[model samples]
Target: MTTDSTRRTPLVRLRSDGAVDEATLAYARTKIDAVLARPGLPAVTGEVRITRAAAHHAGHPWAATADVRVGRRQVVAVAEEATGTELVDRLQDRLRRQTDKAAHYWDDGRGTTAPPWRGGELRDGVSP
Candidate 1:
């Protein structure tokens, strides 16, 4: 549905705590886009965070976290790796697993949510 004339914002947003290279971001985008492109997904929006650890953690400087929403459900993925390649690769796997799990729990063939008449959470009446 996307064409050159019309540009749409990416479904997944990317952010970094420190200097993350353009190449790395672009690669991350591609991986995340793949993960978010499920057939039954509805209005998926996500934020991916790439954090650089302190000097002590030089062996694994890269940390990636993705917070993704599928309809009313939310899933998070996190990874720590030695390089950008590893970070993104692990991120993709983690994100895919989390999203798939959410889908399994929430998505039914009917695509309809539970009726509000069913049940609500029981609130604790005890006060502090």
Candidate 2:
């Protein structure tokens, strides 16, 4: 699989990718659910695609991509690892970073009527 970071929506449907196993898919779903449950986070939609490569790919045969949308922001992260758990962890980390940034940007107080100090204080220390 290609190692380059390609940032775009997946052409295939979310949860429709063929290669991911049931356990891994479940793990990804749980992770997505946790992110969505965050109180200050915006509305989101997301997908995960994990592909296992041939022997020619060497040490990193498992590649995973997570595409997520929070409000008007889109975050995409691609990673390759030797195991499914590691791949999921990396994807979750990347997605968290992206969403955190979006939350910070949108919560900057500029977009709302509240003063900047009030908005900054409201985030429960999630601001960037």
Each candidate's lDDT (Cα)? 0.75, 0.64
Off by over 4 Å in 1: 1-9, 54-57, 107-128
Residue-wise lDDT of candidate 2 within 13-86, one digit each (tens)? 23423345667756765665565557887766666667776565579877877777777778787888887778
TM value for model 1: 0.72
Cα lDDT for residue 10, model 1?
67
Could you tell me every candidate's TM-score relative to the true structure?
A: 0.72, 0.65
Steric collisions counted per model: 0, 0
Model 2 shows how many backbone clashes? 0
Candidate 1 residue pairs in backbone clash: none
Error of 1 at 51 (Å): 1.4
User: Residue-wise lDDT of candidate 1 within 14-33, one digit each (tens)?
Assistant: 77776677778778777877
